[model samples]
Target: MKAAVWYGKHDVRIENKEEPVVQPGKIKIKVAWTGICGSDLHAYHGAPGVIQEGTPHPITGEMAPLTLGHEFSGIVHEIGEGVSEFAVGDRVTVEPMIKCGKCEPCKKGYSNLCDYFGFVGLQSNGGFADYVVVDDYMVHKLPDKVTLEEGALMEPAAVAFHAVKSSQMKVGSKVAVFGVGPIGLLTILCAKAAGASQIIAVDVSKERLQKAREIGATTVINGMEENAVQRILAETGGVDVAFEAAGAEVTVNNAIASIAKKGQVVIESIIPHPIKVDILQITAKEANLTATLGYCGVYKEVIAMVASGQLDVKSIITNKIVLDDLIENGFNLLTSDKSQAKIIVSPQ
Candidate 1:
């Protein structure tokens, strides 16, 4: 099997590795497609500090120098003992978050916050290769209506859905979404489906904001062109919910400043740097500040949303590359001013 293995900071190599086999309580997926994620970009560039040599994975206890690529979907090549919901030849997408079910958060049905949560690509050998071994609990069958490409998007889409749910966005509320990256665009669609009446998709990229509008964003704000704060207030009278999807301090502050008084600000972005914010302004507005970790408890719901033809994943997937080209194509996205929406990695 050929895989793009994580070596260290800025060090990913394409090499042949032994194929993963199905184990008890696990399933083997013949990975059809995987997507390069923002976290992968961070790891690729030497952030996160999770892939360093000899560091133990919090959940799987697997160390670094592992294969990394998560967001994927594929056909079930084989099933393990006790796995009954799916079988060979079944197409499915995986929930990357593998939880320690005995943990307190897991007991509370908030497993996304589990103390020992493990994301596939980061914690173990993920879907970067042609075959990936995942616990049965993490895999779910894709409906016949959905394509393999859309199935690959389920993980990221779940992240967007989780961000929207964390804010507890209300029906007909006005939303201002900052950062129209792939996740940001998906967040807009999720907010719309959750009943946000007016959505302001903000980005420095015109190409991205244009994609956002096509995915159901009612208004688009190019931060490079217009003052986002002035435009939000001007357009919506006031925004009820503000979602920060771009992982930058400036966009986060933009989200904070654009909302209505007492508005809810959902922090979905993982800002690379420590950002100093005006606590006084947030205090003065009496707004609710909420932070979303990755996703949990919503893969099936999001799959349903996509399957129903309600949420469009097609417009967001911008590029597709094969396993041999993963390093070049994937790294290009990290370094370049990507006009692309999302890039998919095909293993087989």
Candidate 2:
């Protein structure tokens, strides 16, 4: 099998490795498409704590130099003992989260907040290969209408959907998303599907803002050219919910400032460093401020939405590459190209 292994910072190598064998309660998938995620980019830049190192992940018991891809979809090639729900040739996408079921959060059905929270690509050998084995619990069968390419996006779409579900958004509610990256674009789509009346997207990139408009954003604001917070406040009289997905201090503060009285703000970006925030802005609005981690129990709903044509996720996919070109055509291209979004990799 050929896999992209992350040995260290700026060091991902496509190497030949032995294929994994299925085990009890596991399923071996012939990987069809794997999407390179922002977390993978963080790891590529040597961001600490993204990938388990030294002592090993508490759940997967594996560390760096492991395969690096979490957003993926595939066909079941083999099913392990004790797994009866799926058989060979089932189309599926993985939730990819690793959690300790005994933890309080897990016990309360919030395993995304479990004490030992980790992810497949970050904590174990993942789908950046020809074949990968995962716990059967991670698999979600794709609807016949959802193509394998769209199935590859279910993981990130789940994240966006979970963020909307976590917000206080309602039918006809006004919403603003700060940062129109892949996740942010999906957030706009999810907010629209959730019945948001006016969807505003903010970003520094004109290209990304255009992409946002193409998807579902009712309005687009280029933060670099205008005062985003002031513009949003003037137009919507303060949105019902504001999402900070840029992972920047300025955007976070703007999101906090752009909400209505008692409005909610959700942070969807995985910011690597702490940034100072204007606490008074949130205090004055009497707003709710929360953040979302990896999703929990939303894969089925996301898949159904895409399958039913409620979400045109495929519209966001800008490029596709083979595993051999993942580093240059996928990772490097994503880093250097602001217009590129949702690049999928095929390892098969």
Candidate 3:
């Protein structure tokens, strides 16, 4: 099996490794298509969280030299003993999260909030290879209408769906999404599908903003060209909900300032640095601030959405590369190309 292994910062090598085998209660999947996620970029740049270096991950108990890919779809190649829910050749996508089922949060149906929550690619061997093994519980069978390429996007779509579902967004309400990256663009589609009347997408990237419009955004704001917060306020008296998906301090500030009084702001990005917020402004507006982590249980819903043609997730794909070209064609291209939205890697 060939796998892309992350040894350190800016160091990813495609090396040959033994194919993973099916274990009892687990399934071996022949990886079809995988997406290069933002978290993968973070690890490539040596940002800690997913790629455990010195200390072992509490859950997977793995460290660096990790295989880096989670947003993927595959075919059921082999079933482990005691696993009868799926048969070989079933097309499926996985819920990459690994949570401690014994935790109180897990018991309360908030497994994503579990104390030792981690992801497959981040914490253990993942799908950036010819084959990967996972517990049968994490697999979700894709509908016949959804192709493997589209199923590769189910992870990120579920992320966007969960972000909107966690926010206090009412039907016909106005909303603004700062940073029209892949997740931000998907958020736009999710908001529209959820009946939002006015969707404003803010981003410095003109290409992404255009995609946002094509997807569902009623308005697009180029933050580099205009004051996003002022423009949003002057036009609509502030949106009902604002989503910060850029993971930048400026966008977070703008998301907080772009909402109306008593509005809600949902934080969807991972900001590593400590930043200041306008506490007085928040206090005066009487608004709410909520933060969402990885998705809880949105895979089935997103699969249904794709099956019904409600979300054209495949349109967001900008590039596809073979496993051999993951570094040069996939990672490097995504980091340098602003127009590139989502890139899928085929480990054939």
Model number with the top lDDT:
2
Q: Would you list the clashing residue pairs of candidate 2?
A: none
* lDDT of every model, 2 decimals: 0.85, 0.93, 0.91
Misplaced by over 4 Å in model 3 are none
TM-score for every candidate vs. truth? Answer: 0.96, 0.99, 0.98
For each of the candidates, give the backbone clash count: 0, 0, 0
- Show the colliding residue pairs in model 3: none
In candidate 1, what are the lDDT values of residues 1-348, reduced to their tens digit?
988889888888888999987888999999999988888888888887655357677667776778898899999999999888888999999998879999899999999889887788888898899899999989988999999999999988998898888785799999988888888888988888888889888888888888888889898888888898999988887688888887777777777788778988899877656887877768989988888988877988999989998778766898899988877776776458557778999986
Candidate 3 residue-wise lDDT, 1-348, digit = tens: 899999999999899999987889899999999999999988898886657678788877887788889999999999999999999999999999998789999999999999988888888888899999988988999999999999899999999999999899989999999998899988988898889999999999989988989888999999889999999999999999999999988888899998999999999988887988886767889999888998998888889999999888998898899999998998888899899899999998
RMSD of 3: 1.0
Name model 1 segments beyond 4 Å from true: none
Q: Report the Cα lDDT for residue 342, model 1.
A: 84
Ranking by lDDT: 2, 3, 1
